[model samples]
Structures are given as structure tokens and as C-alpha cells.
Target: MIKSIGQLFFLALSCLAIAILQFSFISSFPGAFNQINIGLIAMVFILFFFGIKSAILFIFFFGSFMDIFSFQFFSFHLLVLATVSLVVYLILENWLTNKSLYSFWVLCLIASVTYGFISSILLFVFSGLGGGFSIFSLYFWQSLLYQSLWLLLVASLFFNIFVSLAKRFKPFFLEKKGVI
Candidate 1:
């Protein structure tokens, strides 16, 4: 039970780290061409390796953290994050390929598109359509495109690190086998 709690704590810490980095990166840059956000990558990876319920919980916790940090209209970000996490969990577990990099890419693609769409819609709705907040107004499509690429890159990198750490911990498994 302690081991599981430790793992969960680490996972939550990792999620918070990613969220902070993503938020900071976006705020610091604000560049037009470099708008890729990897928040979903962290959530998706957690879902794929752990479980759906865990993913949902992680998203909720992380989203709530975001709500605390956000200056205005906090729930929108939380809603989008939680919604995307749930959708990715369902699609990854039910529809897409699994246990392979190809599946990971597919998940990333779907996640990117869905998140982009939701983000665009939320922006329009929240901004009162900007008096014209169409998808084109905030460069919604372009943001999605770049964000997808960001997800791919960040996911690949983080996945590698995660796998490496898991491998390093393999000895702990053998330690229970009377081999050590």
C-alpha cells in the first residue's frame, strides 16, 4: 500500500511539473509558430501506463491546480483538461492500437485534434465569440497544429524517460523473487 501511494505521489508530482512547465513556456514565449502544448501528453502517458480512473483523477487534480493558478475563468481550462483526458482514455483503451509507438502517435493525434477543437470552442464561447471569435480569430487551427507537434515531441521524450526509469526499477521486482 505504501508503494502504491509513493507511485501515485510521484505521478501527481510529474503532472504538476509538466503543467507548470507548459504554462510557463506559453507565457514566456507567446510566439506564433511555437505554440505546442504537451499537457495532454503527460495525461495520456499516465493513462496508457496506469489506468483510466487514475488518468481522470490526475486530470481533475491537475485541472483544479490550474484553476487555482489561472487569473480569470479558471473552470474553462479545468473543463477542457478533464474532458480531453477522459476522451483520450476512452479512445486509447477502446479504439486505438496499444502497447506500441504507432498507437502512441495515434493517441497524440486524436488528443491534439480534440483538445484543439475544445479549446477553440471554449475560447469562442467564453470570449463571447470575440464579437467574432471564430476558429480563425485566435489562430485556432494553427495552434492545434503546433500543439499536436508539441505533444508528439514531448510525449516521445517523456515516454523514453519513463521507460528508462521503469527499467531501472526492474531490480526491485527481482528482489522479491529471492534472486537478490
Candidate 2:
């Protein structure tokens, strides 16, 4: 139990670090930039290694943290992240084999699209009314493309790290019997 708690603590800190970096980078950018969110990377990591429940819990807490910092109302970020996690859970439960990179790429794409569309739409509906792109436009497409590309890049790096770590910590970290 103590070991499990320690692992969770580490995971939560990792999630927080990802969130902080992502938010800070985006905030630093001048123009409207839609970079791949490290939060998503953390989510995928948690899901693949820890389990679906841990992924959901991390997302919930991470989203809440974002809500507290950002202008968006409380729970808005949570709702979007929760939705993405639910979709990932369903997809993983139904199909996902041998930690396939191909599948991970596809899943990242799906998650990026789902999160981007939902969050953008929600922002538009609530706050973007003041000044925002049309539902269909070049800017919107560009942003989506940027986000997807970012997700791909981040997913590639994260997957590599995960695979390497699993190899190194096979018995304690990656083995089914050793997993908590």
C-alpha cells in the first residue's frame, strides 16, 4: 500500500509538471498558438501504465488545477478532460494490443481532435463570442492542424520514453505481476 501510494504521488507530480509546462508555454506565445498539450501526454502515460481509473483521476485533478488558474469557469476543463478520458477508456477496452505505436498514434489523433473540437467549441460558445473564428475557417483548420501535429510529436517522444522505461524496469515497472 505504501508503495502504491508513493507511485501515485509521483504520477500526480508528473501530471502537475506537464500541466505547468504546457500552460506556461502557451501563455508565453504571442499569437494564437495551439500546441500539443503535455497534459494529454501525461494522460496517455497514466492510462497505459497505471490504468483507466488513475488516468481519469489525474485528468480530473489536472483539469481542476487548470480551471483554478485560467479564466474559464471551474469544471469546464475537467469536463473536457473527463470526456477525452472516457473515450480513451472505451477505445482501449475494446481494442489495443501490445502497446502498438500505430494504435497509439491513432489514439493520440483521436484524443487531440476530440479535445480540440470540444474545448474550442465550448470556448466559442461561452467566451469567444466577443472575438473568434467562424466554425469553419482557415484559422480554425490551422489551429487544428497545429494541435494534431503537436500531439503526434509529443506522443512519439512519450512512447519512446515509455518503451525504454518498460524495458529497463521490466520486472518492477512493466511486468503484469509486478504492476500495482
Candidate 3:
């Protein structure tokens, strides 16, 4: 239990670093990278390695931190992330192997698209409540394309890195028995 707690501590530090990169450095750029959701990417990466418990731990805290800093409401980011996590869980659980890069790429794409669409629609709804904002336009498509390309790039580069790191985390779900 002590070791598990230590590992989670290290994971939280890593999540903090990712969040710093996401909120601080990424915000400096208003280009394609802004369209890329580093939080979502890290959520995918963390989920792949840590199982739902630790993944949710990181995501909830991370999203809360982001929410506290940004204009979004409480649980908005969490809701989007939870939705993405569920989608990933369902798709990966049934149709394909988790180790497949094909699956990783496709899932990353699905996650990026889902994050963009769902968040945009929610933002629209909320903003509409506040103002007369209407969604669905060229900007949305461009943002989606930018985000999709960015996810493809980030996933290709980081999937192996995160998977290898996940080996260290040794997901808490599987039994510890080894076959000889």
C-alpha cells in the first residue's frame, strides 16, 4: 500500500507537469497546438497505463485545476473527460486489442473528435445561455481538422512512451500472478 501510494504521488507529479505544459506553455501559442487538447491526450495516455482509478484521480484533479484557472464551470472538463474515457473504454474493451497502434490511432482520433465536438456544443449551449452565440460554422470545422491532425501527431509520438511508462505503473486491475 505504501508503494502504491508512492507511485500515485509520482503519477500526480507527472500529471502536474502535463497540466503545466498544457495550461502554460501551450497557451502561448494560438495556432494548431492550441487546438490540440493536451489534457485530453494526457488523459488517454494516463488511462492506458494506470487503470480507471488512478486515471480518474489524475483527470479529476487535473480538470479541477484547469477549471479553477479557466472560465469553464465546475465539472465541465471532468464531464468531457469522463465521456471520452467511457468511449475509449467501450471501444477498446470489445472490438480490438489495446496493444495495437492501429487501435491507438483510431481511438485517439475518436477521442480528439469527441472532445472537440462535445466541448464545442457544450460551450455553445453555455455561451448561448449567457449570450446569443450560435455554433456550427467554418471555424468549427477548421478547429476540428487542426485538432485531429494535432492528435495524430501527438499520439504517434507519445503512445509508445506512455505505454512503456505504463509498464512501470503496472495497472492495478490485473492480478499479480505470473505464469512460468
Q: Each candidate: RMSD to true structure?
A: 6.5, 6.6, 6.2
- Give the per-residue lDDT of model 3 (tens digit) for 51-167: 677668888778777776677767778788888888877776777664556777887888888887778777777775675333457777788889888887888788667657656
How would you encode candidate 1's per-residue C-alpha lDDT over 58-157 as one tens digit per residue? 7876777666777747787678877787787788768875456667777888888888788768877887656555566556666777888888887778
Tens-digit per-residue lDDT, 1-180, candidate 2: 999989778867776776777778766865445465778767876786678988887987788778877778777888888888888778877887646677778888878788877887787777747748345767766777787787888788877788787783333434677567
Report the poorest 10 consecutive residues by lDDT, candidate 3: 165-174
Which candidate has the highest TM-score of all?
3
Give the Å error, residue 120, model 3: 1.3
Name the runs in model 2 displaced over 4 angstroms: 1-5, 30-34, 128-134, 168-180
TM-score for each candidate, following the candidate numbering:
0.77, 0.79, 0.80
The lDDT, on a scale of 0 to 1, for candidate 3 is 0.75
Error of 1 at 57 (Å): 2.1
What is the C-alpha local distance difference test score of each model? 0.73, 0.76, 0.75
Angstrom error at residue 11, model 1 = 4.4
Model 3 TM-score, all chains together:
0.80
- Error of model 1, residue 151, in angstroms: 1.1
